[model samples]
Target: MNNLDLQKLLDEMTLEEKIDQLLQLAPAFFEGANSAGQITGPLEGLDLAVENVRRTGSVLGVGGAEEAIHIQEAYLRHNRLNIPLLMMADVVHGYRTIFPVPLAMGSSWDVELVRQAAAIAAKEAAVAGIHVTFSPMADLTRDPRWGRVMESTGEDPWLNGQFARAFVRGYQGEGIANEPYKIAACIKHFAAYGAAEGGRDYNTVDMSEWMRREFYMPSYRAALEEGCEMVMTSFNTVDGIPATGNRRLMRELLRKEWGFDGVLISDWGAVKEMIAHGVAEDEKECALKAIEAGVDIEMMSSCYPHHLQELIASGAVDVQLVNEAVMRILQLKHKLGLFENPHRYADSVAEREILLNEQHLAAAHEAALKSSVLLKNERNVLPLAKDAKVALIGPFATSDDLLGPWSCMGKREEAVTLAAGMLGVADPNTVTAIGCGVEHIPDEELAAMVEAANSAEVVVLALGEDSEMSGEAGCRANIQLPDRQLELVKRVRALGKPLVAVLFNGRPLDLHGVLDEADAVLEAWYPGTRGGAAIAELLYGEANPSGRLTMSFPHSVGQVSVYYNAFNTGRPKDDPNAQVRYVSQYLDIPNEPMLPFGYGLSYSSFRYGEAALSSPLIRAEEKLLLTVTVTNVGERAGSETVQLYVRDIAGETVRPMRELKAFRKIMLEAGETKEIEFEINEPMLRYHHADLSYKSDPGKFEAMVGPNSKEVQALSFELV
Candidate 1:
C-alpha cells in the first residue's frame, strides 16, 4: 500500500481499534476467538477481550507455516480492516539448521560466514511464515556470569558492530520489501542490557553517558544504520529510568538523533514491568509513559489495551501519539507486502524442502568447525591417528545436547552425538562410557569409566555445562565445571593415559582442573546440529581448529568481569622488578585472565615478523600503512587470525590499555609467509569525551600486531 492508502486506513481506524493494533498476542488467542466474540482455550490469564484479540496487530512465537496460515486465516475473518497478523520469533542464531551460538560465531572472526548463517536462518524462518526475527543481539558484554552473554557476539565494541551489520544484511537481504525468502531483523535490547549489575539478568545498569557511548552504543548504532527494521527495548534502566519509558533514551536519542523511524517494540512485557521497576503507579501510567517514550508495539502486555483508550480520553495521552504508532505499524505491514498477500512466504511444502536442507547443513558444519577454539595443545597429542584406540567418557559422550538455548525449531533427538562421530572416524576398538552426569558421579559409573580409560590408548573427556545452565535465565554464581567432572578428570589422570578435553557450553567458564589435567583442550561452545561431526573431523586431523576466544576466560569466578581492554592504573604492575606493595596488584592471583581474547591454537605454528610502518606520523584523513609478515612455521596447513590493536597514550580522558581496531583471517600452507597490512588513521583513535564529544587527541599512539591480545610486538607512532 502507498502512503495515502496507509494514512487513509489509519484515519479510518476507531480509537479502540487503533489502540488494539499496538498489542501483540500469541497464536492461542487467534485460535480461540469465536463468532460470539468470546476468547477461549486457556487464555484467561490475559486481560484482552475477544474484539481486541481479533484485531491484534501481531502474533508472537507461531510454530510453523501451517499454524501461521491458520492464524492468519482465522484472524482476517474477524479483523475488520483485514490487516494480516505480523509473525515474529526469537531466531537468534539459526532456525532449523542450528549453527554455533553468536558468541562462538564471533570467535570465528569471519563476518562473511556470520552473514551466510543468518541468511540461511532467514530462509528457513520465512518458509515457516515468520516475518521478523529478534536477532543479532548487539549488546557488548564483559561478564560471563551473565547467561545472555551467549547471545552477544563478544565484549568489544568495534567487533560487535561488524557482526551486527553482517546480521542485518543477511536477514533483510537487499531489503525485506524487495525480497521473498527474507525476514525483517530486529536488533535487540536497545540500550546496555549486557552491563547488568553483578552479571545478573535484568539487573540495574548504572554507567555514565560517556562510558555508554564509548563501549555499549556502537553496535546498536551500526545495526540501525544498516537498515534494521525494528528495535527491542531492554529490560534494564538507562540513567535511572526504565528504557521502555525513558523519553530521553527512546524518543530523543534513538528517534530524533539516530533517525530510526522503524518500529520500536517493548521486550516481552517490559512496558508493564515498569510498574515493577517502581516508576509507574499503575497500568494507565504505564501506557502513558511507554507511548510518550515512543514504544510502537507492546509484546505480551495488556497495559496498552487495558488503559490506553482511557488515557487518551482523559487527555493524559494525545490521540496523535496513538495515530503515529499505529501508522508505523501499518507502514511495516505495507513494506512486507502483507496487504497484497496475507500468507506471505507461508508454504508448508516449501518449509519441508528448505528447512535443514543439505546445503544449510554444510554451512552449519563449517561454522561449527571454525568456531571451535583449541585453547590448549600441550604436545602433538592431537590429530589422533584413525587406528588408535579411543575411550570417550562423561555425560556428553553419547548425549545429543549440542543445541544450546533459543534453538528455534531444532530437535535435540535428531542431533548427532559425540560417540557416533568418534565411532565413524576412529578404529573399531574405540569404546564409550558415561562416567557421570553434569554434576554427579555414581561409584559404579566411576569404576566402569576407569576400566574403559585403562584399556584405551587415549581418553577424550567430554565435559561442560548443560543446555539448561546457560541462556536467558541461566546465570550462575560459580562458572567452574562440576566437581564430579573434575573428579572424573583426576581419576582418568591417575590411569596415566593421554587425555583430551572437549567442552560443550554457551559462556566461558573457569576451566581450572580441566585446563591443567588435560593434554589437549577444545572449547567447542554449543556447536549446533552437526557439532559432533565437526569435532570428530578436528580430532582425526581431517580439519584444523581455527576459532579464537571472543570473551576472556576468567581464572576464577572472583574475577568475573576480566577483559583485555582495561584501563591502566597510576600505580602500575608492569615492572616485574619493582617489589612495591603499593602497586595495583593481586596478592594471590594474577591480574590477567587464564586465556585472553583472540587466543587460539592451530596444529600448524605461526611466527610473526616485526611490524613495519610506512610513516611514523599521520594526521586526520591521512592513512599510515602498517605491515607484518606471518609465516606458518610448523609442518601442517592451517588458518590464523592476525589481530591489530591500538593504544592511545594520552587522550581527552583515559583510554583502554589496548583496543582491537582490525583483524585478518588467512589460510597458509606449511612454510608459507604472507604480508598483512592495516591502515591507521585519526578516526581509529577517537573516543567519546567527558562532555560527550567524539574526537581524538593529537599525541603519541602505539600499534601492536600479533595472534592474540596478550602476546604481541609493539611500535610507536605520532598522530597530529
Candidate 2:
C-alpha cells in the first residue's frame, strides 16, 4: 500500500484496532498457529478478547509454511480489512539447516563466511514463511556465565560490530525492502544487555556511561547503520532507567542522535517487566512509558492492548504516539509486501524443496569446520593418523545433540555423530568408541572407557555442556568442565595414553583441568549438524584448524569478566621493573586469562616479522600505513589469523592496555609468506573520553602485530 493508503487505514482504525497493531503474541492466543515460540505464561492473564487477538498485527515464534498459511488465513477470515499476520521467530543460528553459533562464527574471523551462513539461514526460514528474525544479537560479552553468550559474537566491540553488519547484510541481502528468500534482521538487546552484573542473565546492569559508549554501544549502532530494520530493547535497566521506558536512551539518543526510525520492539514481556523493575506502578503506566519511549511493538505482553486505550482516553499519552507506532508497524508490513499478498511467504512447495538440501548442509559443515578453534596441540598430538587405532568416548561420542541450543528448526536425528563421522573418514578397523556420560561417571562407565582406551592407540575424549546447559537460561555459576568429566580426564592422564580432548561447549569454558590433562584440546562449540564430520576431518588431517578465541577463557571463576582489552592500572602487572610485592599480580595465579582472546592453535606454526610503518606521525586526513610480513613456517599448509592491536599511551581518561583495531585471516601454503598491511585512521584511535565525547587525544600510540593479544611486536606512532 502507498503512504496515503496506510494513513487512511490508520485513521479508520478504532482504538482497539490501533492497539492490536502494537500487540504481539505466541500461537496459543491465535487459532491454527502452532507453538513455535515460547509462551511467557497463559493467555488468561492477558484478559484480551478473541477478536482483539484475531486482529493483532503479528504473531511470534510460529514456524512452518503450512502453519503460517493457516495463521494468516485464520486472521484474514476474522478481520474486516483482510490484513495478514506478520510471522517472526527466534531464528538465531538457523531455521532448519543449522550453522555454528554466533560465538563460534566470531572465531572464524571470516566476515564473508559468517554472512553466507546467515544468508543460508534466511533462505531456509523465508521458505517456511518467516518474515523477521531476532538475530545477530550484537552484544559484546565479557563473561561466560551468561548462557546467552552463545547468541553473541563475543568480547570485542569492534569485532562484534563487524559481525553485526555481516549478519544484517546476510539476512537483509542488499536491501530486503523488496527482496524474496530473505527476512528482516533484528539487532537485539539494545544497549549493554551483556554486561549483566555477576554474569547473571536479566540481572542488574550498572555501568559508567563512558564504559557503555566505549565498549558496549558500538555493535548496536553498527547493526543499525547496516540497515537492521528492527531493534529489541534489552531487559536490564541502563543508567537507572529501563531501556524500554527510558526516554533518554530510546528517544533522545537512539531516535534523535542516531536517527533510527525503524521499528523498535520490546523483548519478551519486557514491557510489563517494568512493574518487576519497580519503575512502573501498573500496566497503564507501563504502556504510557513504553510508547513515549519509542517502542513500536510489545512482544508476548498485554501492556499495550490491555491498558493503552484507557491510558489514551485518560490523556496520559497523546494519541499521536499510538498513530506513529501503528504507522511504523504498517510501513514494515508494506515493506514485506504483506498487503500485496498475505500468503506471499506461504509456499509449501518451496518449503519441501529448499530446506536442508545437500548444498545448505555442505555450507553448514564448512562453517562448523572453520568455527572450531584448536585451543591446544601439545607435542604435535593432533592430526591423528587415519591408520592409528583411535578411541572416542563421551556422552557426545555417538549422540546427535551437536545441533546445539537455539537450533530452532534443526532435526536432531539427521545430525551426524562422532562415531559416524569417524567411520566415514577413518579405517573402520582403527576406530573404537564408547558412550561415557559427560557427568556422573560411574565405575562401570570408567571401566568401559579404560577398555576402549586399552584397545586403542590414542584417546579422543569428546566432552562439554549438553544442548540444554548453555543457551538461553543456561547460566552457570562455575564455568568449568563438570566435576565428573575433570575426574575422568585426570584418570585418563594417569593411564599414560596419548589424549585429545574434543570439547563441544557454547560459551568460553575454564579449561584449566582439561588443558593440564590432555595432549590436545579442540573447542568445537555447539557446532551444528555437520559438526561431527568437521571434527573428524580436522582430527584426520583433512582440514587444518584455524578458528581463534573471540571470548577469553578465564583462569578462574573469580576472573569472570576478564577480557583482552582492559584499562591500564597504575600498578600494572606488565611492568617488568616493578617489584612483585607491590605489583597488581594475583598471589595464587598470574593476572592473565587461562586462554587469552584471539588465541587459537593450528597444525601449522606462524612467524611474524617486525612491523613496518609508513610514517611516525598520522595527520587528520591521512591514514598511517603499517605492514607486517607473516610466514607459515610449519610443514603443512594452513590458515592464520594475524591480529593488529593498538594501545593509546595517553588519553583524557586511561586507555585499555591494548585494543583490537584490525585483523586479517590469511590462508598460506607451507613456508609461504605474505605482507599484510593495515591502515590506521583517526576513528581507530578515538575512544569515549571522561565526558563521554569520542576523540583521539594527541599522543604517542603503540601499534602491535602478532598471532594473539598476549604476545606482539610493537611499533610507536603519533596521532597528530
Candidate 3:
C-alpha cells in the first residue's frame, strides 16, 4: 500500500485510536501477550487500560515466535482496520546466538565480520518475529566511566561511522521488503548522548555546535546514509534542552537538513522526563513538545496517549502531526510486508533451527577470537603447551556469564566456561577454582586456588567485572578491578608460577595492578556465548589474536576521557625545548594511556618497512599513493590491522595530533611480505574549520603507517 492507503486508514481512525498508535508499550500490557503477567508495575504505573494496549502502535519486546504471533493475532481481532503491532526489541549484540559486544566488534577492525555478525543477529531476531532492532549504537564515546560505552563502537568518529553503515547493511540486508530474515536497524542516542558530562549516564551534554558536528554527528549521518529505518532520541539534553523535545535538533536538523523521513522514536520514558529536564510543565506540555519535535513513537511512556488527544483538540498540536507519524508506522509495516502477512517470519519451526545454529555459533566464535585483544604477552609465555598442567583460577573459571548485557534471548547456561574450554586442550591434571567473585574473595576459595597454583606448571587467572558491572548504568569511578580481585592476583603472583590473566569486561579499564602482575594479559571482552571456546583457541595457539583497542585504556581514571585524536597544547609535553615543570603534563601519571587506540598484539611478530610516497606533492583531485611493506617476522601466520593516519601541520583550527583516515586488515604467512598501498585524495584531508565550514586548506601534511597509532613510520607531503 502507498501513502493514499495509509492516509485513508488514518482518516478512518477516531482521535483516540490515532493517539493510541503513537504509544509503544511492553508486551506484558497486552492481555494475550506471551508474558501477560510478566510485569505488573509498568502497567499500573502508566495507568494504561487493556483496551489502550490492544490499539498500541508497537510492542517493546516479544519472548519468541509464538509470543509475537499470539500478540498480533490477539490485537488484530480487536481492531477494526486490523493494523498489526510493530514488534521491536533491543537486540544490541545478538538475539539468541550472542556475539561479542559492540566495543569488542570494533576492535576486530573487520567491517565485513561485524557486518556478518549483525546479519546473523537479524536472522535470529526476525525469525522470532521481531521487526526492528535498537542496534548499532553509533555514539562515539571517549569516557569509559559511562557504562553504555560498551554499546558504542569507540572514540573515533570515522571508525564509528564505518561500523554504523556496516550494521545497517547487515541488519536490513538488501531490504526488509525483499529479505524476510532481516530486521530493520535503528541507529540510536542521536545528538551526542555519549558525551555526557562526568561520563555519567543521563547527564547533561553541553558541547559547541562545531564539536558535535566535527566529532560526534558523523556516525549518525553515515547510518542514515545507509538507509537505517529509524532514529531513537537520547535521554540527555543538548544545549540545555532535552533531545526528545528539542525542535531544532529533531525537526530542523535531522528531518529538514538531513532529509530523514523514517520513524523517530524516544528512548525509554524520555518524553515525560522533559518535565524533569525543566522544559515541559507536565504530560500535556511533554506531548505537545515531543510531537512538534517530530517524535513518531514514545517508548514506555504515557505522555502521548494520556495527553496527545487533548492537546490536539485544544489546537496546541496539529492533527497532521499524528497523521504523519501514523503514516510512517504504516510505511514500516508495509516495508516489512506486515500489512500482507502480520506474522511474517514468525516461524516457530524455523526459529528453533536458526537460533543458535552451528553456523551462527561458528560466526560468534570467530568474532570472539578476532575481537579479543592481546594486551601483553611477555617472553612468548602465551600459546601455552597443550600438555602443561594448567591451573585456571578466578571468578569466571566456571561461570557461564559470558553473554554480556542486552543479550535479548541468549541463555547463560548454554555458555561454554573457561574451565570447559581448557579441558579440551590441557592435560588431565589441570585444576580449576573460582578464587573470588567480582568484588569479593572467600578464605576457602583462596586456599583452593593457592593449592592448585602450587601443583600446576602454569597459572591462568581469569578475572573481570561481572556482567552487571559494565553496561547501561554500570558506571565506575575508579574503572579498575575490585580490591579483592587485585588481591587474588597478588597471591597468584607470589607462587612464582608462569601467570597469565584474561579479562572479561565491557569498558576499557585501568590495568595498573593486573598488568604488572600477569606475565600475559588477554582482554577477552565479555565474549558472547562461544567466548570460552574462542579464548581457549587464542591461548593454545589454535587461532592468532588480531583484535585491537578501539578505545584507549587509561593509565588511571584521572584520564577518563583519554583518546589518540587530541589537539596538542602550546606547551606540549613532548617538546624538547619546553620545560618539564612548565609543560602541560600530569604530576602523577603520563599524558598517554596504558594502551592506545588501534593497538593490539599477535603471536606472530610484524616488521614494517620505510614508507615511500609516489609524489612529494599533489593538487586537488590528484591521488597520492603511500606504500609500505609489512612482513610477518615470527614462526606463525597472523593477521595485522594496518592503520593509516594523517596529521595537519597547520589548520584554520587546531586538528587532532593523529586522525585515522583509512585502515586495512591483511593476513600474512610466516615469512611472507606484502606491499600495502593507500590512495589518498584531497577530500580525505578535509576538516571542519572554526567557522564550521567543512573543507580542506592548502597545507603541509604528514602521513603515517603502522600496526598501531603510536608506533608508525611517517612521510611528509604538501597538498597545494
lDDT of 3 by residue, 1-720 (tens): 887887788889888888888898888777567664123123445888777887899987788899999889989999878999999988999999999999999999999998999999999999999999998899989999998899999999999999999999999988888776989999989989999999998889999988999999999999999999999999899888999999999999999999999999998888888888999899889999999999999988899888888888888889999988888888998898888899989999999999999999999999999999999999888989988888888888888889987888999998888888878756645645454577878878888888888888889999998988888878888899988889888998998999999999999999988999999999999899999989998999999999999999999999878999999999999899988799988999999999999999999999999899999897898999999999999999999999999999999989999999999899999999999999998999998988989999998999999989999888899999
Two-way lDDT contest, 2 vs 3, winner: 3
Q: 279-386, model 2: which lDDT tens digit per residue?
A: 999988899899999999998788898888888888888999999998998988888888988876668898888999999999999998899999888889989999
Look at candidate 1 and give me any clashing residue pairs.
none
- Candidate order (lDDT): 3, 1, 2
lDDT of 1 at 621: 85
Give the TM-score of each candidate. Answer: 0.98, 0.98, 0.98
Model 1 earns a TM-score of 0.98
Candidate 2 colliding pairs: 37-61
* C-alpha RMSD for every candidate: 2.6, 1.3, 1.5
| Residue range 1-720, candidate 1, lDDT tens digits | 799999999988898889989998776677732221111112344677889888889987788888889889988888888988899888988998999899999999999999999999999999998999999899999999999999999989999999999999999999998877989999989899999998998889999988899999999999999999999999999999999999999999999998999999998778888988999998889989999999999887888999998888888899999999999999999999899998899899999999989999999999999999999888788988888888889879988999898898888986778887888777656655453688777978978988899998989999998998999988989898888888889999988899999999999999999999999999999999999989999988999999999999998888878999999988778866666787887888888999999999999999999889899999898999999999999898999999999999988898999999999999999999999999998889889988998999888999999999999889999987
> Lowest summed-lDDT stretch of 10 residues in model 2?
35-44
Model 1 regions more than 4 Å off: 32-45, 433-436, 575-579
Candidate-wise lDDT, in order: 0.90, 0.88, 0.90
Give lDDT: candidate 3, residue 86. Answer: 94
